[model samples]
Target: MKHVIALDVGGTGMKAALVGAEGELLYEARRETGRERGPEAVVEGILAFAAELRGYGIEHYGEPASAAGVAIPGVVDAEKGVAVFAANLGWENVPLRDLLTERLGGLPVALGHDVRTGGYAEGRLGAGRDADRFLFLALGTGIAGAIGIDGVIEPGAHGGAGEIGHVVVRPGGVPCGCGQRGCLERLASASAVTAAWSAATGDPRATAADCSRAVDAGDPRALAVWEEAVEALADGLLTAITLLDPRTLIIGGGLAEAGDTLFVPLRAAVASRITFQQLPSIVPATLKDTAGCLGAALLAWDLLDTEVRA
Candidate 1:
């Protein structure tokens, strides 16, 4: 059975799979990224993980993986197959693609920004499947987005596009690690909600999921926190909608797991704020946490197809 190795590299962990030509996941696995050790350690972890997957394919599938793909956090020079910078991983201008290819014995490898790769998968196989234009928002530990146009996720000129989370929705409100004050991400991300809920309950262990539960129980404090997040997210989304005019908006990541708790209010809030902007069809991503891994597989398949065509 022919297969390709696919890996999704996150700040703390990695999801990997061996995908058959028909896009079925022949095998799946997960492991820590080992980022706590250091940036170099993280790179080593990724290389080791990919090599292991290659070996697995060779053993179980009767042949070595023909190609590999990885989706990673932070700035990526996809065209050059380099991970430019990842603040969380403390890396700068890492030639990650070459390292992975070399580790996998020169297998063709494709590298992409994590959010963009996931969004592309959503556009192709999930919520935004038929949409001509859409924006995929990931409300995770930090917020990020990818603009999908005609089934392709646009990587922008500098690989920094679809940064809807960075829009200053509340100037001078809260400082963000991005060195920006009151960016939407600081107020609307899952981590932001966790922080707000923790501070409100005076419990360091309180999380965004707790906040969502509290909201379900009609707790005023949780309501306040959730409301703030929704408002800020709406403002930020409006900015994107005005600029992109996407026909659909696919919401994903941890926050989206809130389901109606996040989507109901989010839709209402966005609708309440729109003046002339089109109210995009807001929908939750169907892929959940597995989107990145599936997307990585898609990237690997795309690489193979491109090579065959060339």
Candidate 2:
């Protein structure tokens, strides 16, 4: 009946769960990140959320949680257990792991980058489970990626590796918040497609989902928008494939919900672009939004193991 608390803190909301030793989810919950209120408020919200989950585990299992894990966006120093920076949350250099451990009565807490942590789940339990090497991409409002090797997500030397979204595919095309022009996310992410589709149809509210439906209906304008995004994505992915040579490519996040609409053309586009690089299996992710929580649990469990070994 032992369990750990898992939390995935996103820009707008947080997903949490109580996970057993065998990776079974005992309970799940969600909360607004309260980012609009301010960074300090957001930190307090996360602490409160983790405390509540810990309380639930104690009440149900008659013991406190063994450990806790959290995944947050932006720059994170996992080794230092500090959330270095998160633009969406307006946070900088917050000692999140220390804060959580203090809140949970000294329970060990692991902090990770959201995309990389989610890819850890996908690598071990989802589409990348069988691959020795894989790249997991989350095509959300903004694209992000994780590189997995030998069942582990590589944190890279500085912990900023696997940032495929920042790969420049369209030189001098569009400006990115990261201070780059023609970054992959600006050209190929869900938000990019939404912007393109909205401008094309003169509907300010048109979304990437709407574009997908229109593509299904054989709308030429939607086809144009989708194709543009697909082509840019292919260009970016080709760079990853060339550099990483992964055996599998797992696609997740909101835009990935398009399923075949995104996959079929994407596969063809990548195939057409690749010459010397071996084409990796382009597959859709199975965990959806829950991957982050599951991965956070994995981190918590890993932390417990490391503690026992030490």
Q: Candidate 1 residues 157-242, lDDT tens each?
A: 89999888889999998998889899999999999999999999999999999999999999999999999999999999989999
Tell me the alpha-carbon RMSD of every candidate: 1.0, 0.6
Cα lDDT, model 2, residue 159: 96
The lowest-lDDT stretch of 10 consecutive residues in candidate 2 is 169-178
Question: Candidate 2 residues 237-261, lDDT tens each?
Answer: 9999999999999999889999999
Tell me the TM-score of each prediction against the true structure.
Answer: 0.98, 0.99
- Clash numbers, per candidate: 0, 0
User: Would you list the C-alpha lDDT of every candidate in the order shown?
Assistant: 0.92, 0.95
Write out the backbone clash pairs for model 1. Answer: none
After superposition, the stretches of candidate 2 with alpha carbons farther than 4 Å from their true spots are: none
lDDT at residue 296 of model 1 (Cα atoms): 84
